[model samples]
Target: MKVNGKVIVVTGAGSGMGRALSLQLIKEGARVAGIDINEEGLRETRDLTGKASAAMSTHVVDITDRERVEALPAELIALHGAVDGIINNAGIIQPFVPIKDLAYDRIERIFNINLYGTLYMVKSFLPALLERPEAHIVNISSMGGFIPFPGQSFYGASKAAVKLLTEGLYAELKDSNVKVTVVHPGAVNTNITKNSNVEMRSDVSAEEQASMTLSAEKAAEIILNGMKADKYRVMVGKDARFLDLFYRFSPKRAVDFITKKMAQMAKAS
Candidate 1:
């Protein structure tokens, strides 16, 4: 569905792709309800909007809090009059360690925020979305969701659940007015490590890292274009696109390739 004049709810709107999505949505004449756990970050996002900030509203709520998430539809509708779309963009990564070395608490935290949080937003906003003449849901999975990223096994598992959840929702809603899209973004330039509160052990220079990933703004643009076209899935970067095809051709080889890359990065760091 076209975003113009629509009231779209974007999670993780404090920064990264979420902030980029908000800015772009407003630029395209859509009203945005930006949600994030960080009030300061939300404020920064709003400030960045300048005069167009009036077209956006910022909500400080953790998607993992069921009660708070449940309350969002009403609050958003009161402010924007209606809800047309929702982008489940808030997520974090696990510590860069093998699953055997990962703690139960850390595993639970990743699942809670990545899987359950996205689920809660879907359940809460779906009814409101259904009320619209046309609506859309976009869930951000990751390249890791479709392929193993050695150290981030659990993070990949959570996003993989999201990938299936979104696809299933598409099947269920195909006959309805609501459209569902699952996005798999390769590495995008964002402070996910800092935001996730996990240290990334990487000896790769900043220039090398930047060369390897898509910018947050560019990723958002591709995602929005996919949503406008009502696509079922979108790969946000060339790395994501290439790896997807490679994995389909030979899963074992793809896994081995990633495993080798992980080992090299580990040794370099």
Candidate 2:
């Protein structure tokens, strides 16, 4: 679906890739409704958009709250007159610990934000999206969704659920006007660690961080391009593409490789 002139909703729009997506979509002549729990971050995003900020609306709503999520379409319609697409980009990571040491409450929080939050947005907006002549839904998964990282078991599981949920949506909505796309992103330079309030398993040096991660802006560009092409699967960054292919051909080898690397990182930490 072409983003030009469309009214799109993006969650986690306060920071990271979501902020980038909002800015980029506005640049492409699309009106965007940015949703985030952080009012300050949303203001910052709006400030950063300059004159293009007129095409954007910032909403401070928590996606995990079903009532608020359900009511978002009406609020957005009042502002933009119509809704064309949604990007479920709000997600958080769990503490860097083995599953055995993970708390049930923490696991629930991760699933609530990562999986159920996406579900709430999709379900809430599906009716509005279906009404559009052409609509798109983009859900951001992760490399951990497919290739498990040792200390991120629950987070990976949550995203794995998102991956399957998005794929199922695509299958069910294939003949409909709505298009669904799931994204798998490799490590990206974002404030996810700070936002999620989790300690990194490895104290990554600045150089290592830069080398391993894609910029949020670059990831946003790749994602927007994929959505414009109506691609069902969008993998951001070379690492995401390579690991996806590697896991497809050799699941066991991929798992073993990542496990070893994660084990070493954990030991170092």
Candidate 3:
């Protein structure tokens, strides 16, 4: 779908990929409503945009809150007069822990934000989206979803749910104007790790992490192009593409390799 002049709502629009995408969309001529639980981050995103008024709006919201999620379209509609698309990007990664040892609260919190949050946003805006002759929904999954790493099982599970959910939407909406796209990104340079209690086993030094990771701007560009192309599954970054293939070629071998590498890294560190 053409982004120009489109009415778009982006969840998690406060920072990282969401913020970058919101800025890009505004540059491309789309009216944007940026939503996030972090009001300060939302304000920061607003400040980055070129125009103070054009295609720019922000809201503070928790996607896990069903009532609040449902209210988004009504609120945006009240202001913009219509809705055109939804980008379900808000997600959370829990701390590194084996599933058996993982805290119930941590696991639940991850799902609430990553999985159910996307679902709620999709359901809330889909009715309005379908009314348009052409509409779009973009859901952000992760490379972890395609292949679960040992310590980050919960995060993988939540994103795995998103992968399936987006695929299912595409299947169901094949006859309709609505298009669904899922993005899988690997190790992007974002505050995602700092925001969560999650730890990395890769022995990646802070500086190394800074250098190797993809920027949020590049990630946004990949997703934007994928959405425009109506791609059902979009993979971003070299690492993400590699994981996608490695997992498919040999799941056990790939998992075992990651386990051994992470363990070796932790021991050496």
- Candidate topping TM-score: 1
lDDT, candidate 3, equals: 0.88
lDDT digits (tens) for residues 109-197 of candidate 3 = 99999999999999999998999879999999999888878778999999999999999999999889999999999889888875565
Return the lDDT, model 3, position 268: 76
For model 1, residues 78-167, the per-residue Cα lDDT tens digits are 988999999999999989989899999999999999999999999999999998999999999999999999989999999999999999
On a 0 to 100 scale, what is the lDDT of residue 226 in model 1?
Answer: 100
TM-score of each: 0.99, 0.97, 0.95
- Give the higher-lDDT candidate: 1 or 2: 1
State the lDDT of candidate 2 residue by residue for 38-91, as single tens digits: 999999999999988799999999899999999999989987899999999999
What lDDT would each prediction earn against the true structure? 0.96, 0.94, 0.88
lDDT score of model 1?
0.96
Compared with the true structure, model 1 gives a TM-score of 0.99
| Runs off by more than 4 Å, candidate 2 | 201-203
Best by lDDT: 1
Where model 3 places Cα greater than 4 Å from the true spot, the runs are 199-206
Candidate 3 lDDT trough over 10 residues, lowest sum: 194-203
